[model samples]
Target: MSSDFEPILMRNVGVAKAADLQVYEARGGYQGIRKALQMSPEELIDEVKKANLRGRGGAGFPAGMKWSFLPKERKVTYLCVNADESEPPTFNNRVLMESDPHQLLEGIMIAGYATRATVAYIYMRGEFTEPFHILQRALNQAYAAGYFGKKILGSDFSMECYIHRGAGAYVCGEETGLIESLEGKRGWPRIKPPFPAVAGLFAKPTVVNNVETLCCLPHIVLRGAAWFTAIGPQGSFGPKLFCVSGPVNRPGCFEESMNITVKDLIYGSKFAQGMIGNKAVKGVFPGGLSMGVLTGDELEMRMDFDSPRKFGLLGLGTAALVVFNEDTDIRDVLLNVTRFYAMESCGQCTQCREGTGWMYKIAQRISLGAGRREDLDILVETTRNMGMMPGLSICGLPDGAAFPIRTLVEKFRAEFEQHIVRQEPGKVERVLRVLN
Candidate 1:
């Protein structure tokens, strides 16, 4: 499963004293910014655009395209680094921050220069106590070396970086929500039309990028766009850091090209290796928990930004895979997932607040053996009517809630029906036929 491709973002991860500034500099760290300093802001943006680097956050929007959204002439453009890696089991960001904090800082410097942002803020999750301290130490090292303050690396472009710890709200992972929390307000997502690119972080033009996305900047700056696009399939460019959890022999983050299939990821020698005790995989949340589930039979799909759409998932969300074994109960998984979304909702949108709660309640009843045959239908219908797809919620939290519950119920309909307790004689038969 090991390809000829070398690690870019993760090159310095396992080295001794990897987080040290001298170690990073010795490995050609600040060269990207040095090269970037010579280029105009337009050139920097164009270079990233040519690389086809998409945001590694849930959305997978093109990073360069996002940077280009800023107004042509803004006096105070801000770059908000989304370090709030709140997605469940998605600690690749935390790893990057802790293991290679300098890489992240260099990326921020490059991106800030590209966007002409005078200030950059790393919005960290409150739970990232260790990473926050490690990154703060690294920031101090960078500032002392003149890489963060004015005239970085002896260049005219100057940007200041700061770490803003959040209250660990899952909603703050959203760009607008992060901005709201940064501005000392509740972490509720603002509606679009005045999108973050136009008005963000105190009503100024802003660009919010995820930790992993920024980490790719230094590599793209040094390697060129053609080098990145050559690694993975078209539109799924660059080397990707994948977080694989659950009952796997090697359950942790691994970096590889996007050419790897979901099957390869689970069973590949260089990746997760195989399931624990050789147990059969019942299902996998190939992306994050919210991106929906892939039945065991669906493991042939590739792990890419585009592949999941064909299989009815939300998208390649954080590229974090959580696998479950055959002995596990899909109903319980749904209940747990629904309960999380229901609790994490910002309560800004009626659909998300009410829909997630109702879904969780129905899932709870199903898990508790009190489920009605019609409960399954109600869950599916509720998901369909809520979220951005139905234009019902302010943010995509409802959409996130909908994907897993809907996919689990739709794909594992029989399992859900079997849990209905056979309260009525003909009810189980009717439930089985609902999909037919």
Candidate 2:
């Protein structure tokens, strides 16, 4: 539990005392926001652009690029911080919010100033009750210090933020879905012809960013973009918080430079304990279940935005690493993830609504000892087709749910085949429990 006084989001959490307004100020916190107030909005955006910080939520879209998309005219822009960390096995955002509330608050204020957003919203997940209160307290502190509300820091610029709790739908994590929830509507994603930058909440220009993504803004402004860019691997800039779980002995979150390899992270002491039961490492879901699977041999590949791209996988989604060992069953893993998508699908898009359910049923049948050998091919083909379907889908919900299935089937075909051949009753129950 002992570690150095690293300023990474999770660095001082659980070991040293939590950072409060006084402690944060003593440690050079809020310096970014203070520095940001001195720069023009365009200058702040330019600084972020130079940092090359892509969104940390699932998609790796550039943060400054998204900000630049906002209309240049003086309209009421909005900055919505997506704190709904609902992606399965992803808990990095939660750590950031709970441990370093001031950092997030500072980031939001800076972002609001840059975007000229009159109002900001932190869309917290329903389960994040504790973090919600923590953030609420931080917001109160920020306002008390004149960091929020009218004429922030005695400048003409002004920004106000409110916390909106989601109703526990995974779809709400999608940017548009989060918007809909903020608008007091059902948490369903809206079409994107008029992207959020153009027409968003209350039909105003909005910039939706992840908690971790926004949290990095203050650091980028305080340290300069070059320093942030130079820390991580090429293209993948700044320190990344990887939430490693599953059978690892130390199943917790770690914030490290992107230079760390997947092997180093898996074996790093930051995790809960290493791998459980001395089980041989089988494979890893590098960026949660949404990104495609990586076998043990691929462990040497550095965990970065581009490294996984070479293998037809993405590194930015959720920033969660779920490791599986030899004793873990691939079928059970597929079933578990499929059911999650099936339950979370908003049913707005016919393809995602029906396809996710179909995939779940097939996975359930196979895991229940009722599947045939040919069912494997059906699962693979269904996932492939689902990935091609078109709709008003604002996010990759369909693809997120299908990518793992397709990868698992392709990489662990023999294991899936074994499930059908054995038809063990005990195995069926175990797989179902894991899926649930």
Which candidate gets the maximum lDDT versus the true structure? 1
Query: Among all windows of ten consecutive residues in candidate 2, which has the lowest summed lDDT?
Result: 385-394
What lDDT does model 2 reach?
Answer: 0.82
Task: Give per-residue CA lDDT, model 1, range 2-102, as digits (tens).
Answer: 67768788888889999999999998888998988889989989999999899999899999999988988789999999999988878889889989999
* Global Cα RMSD, each model: 3.7, 3.7
Single out the weakest 10-residue window by summed lDDT for candidate 1: 427-436
Which pairs clash in model 2? 58-317, 249-272, 249-273, 250-271, 250-272, 250-273, 251-272
Stretches of candidate 1 off by over 4 Å are 421-436
Tell me the spans in candidate 2 whose CA falls farther than 4 Å from its real position: 1-7, 14-19, 270-273, 388-394, 424-436
lDDT of 2 by residue, 96-208 (tens): 88888888998999999889999999999999988998889888988898889999988999988899888889889888888999999988888776999999888999999
Query: How many steric overlaps does candidate 1 have?
Result: 0
* lDDT against the true structure, each candidate: 0.89, 0.82
Q: For candidate 2, what is the total of clashing residue pairs?
A: 7
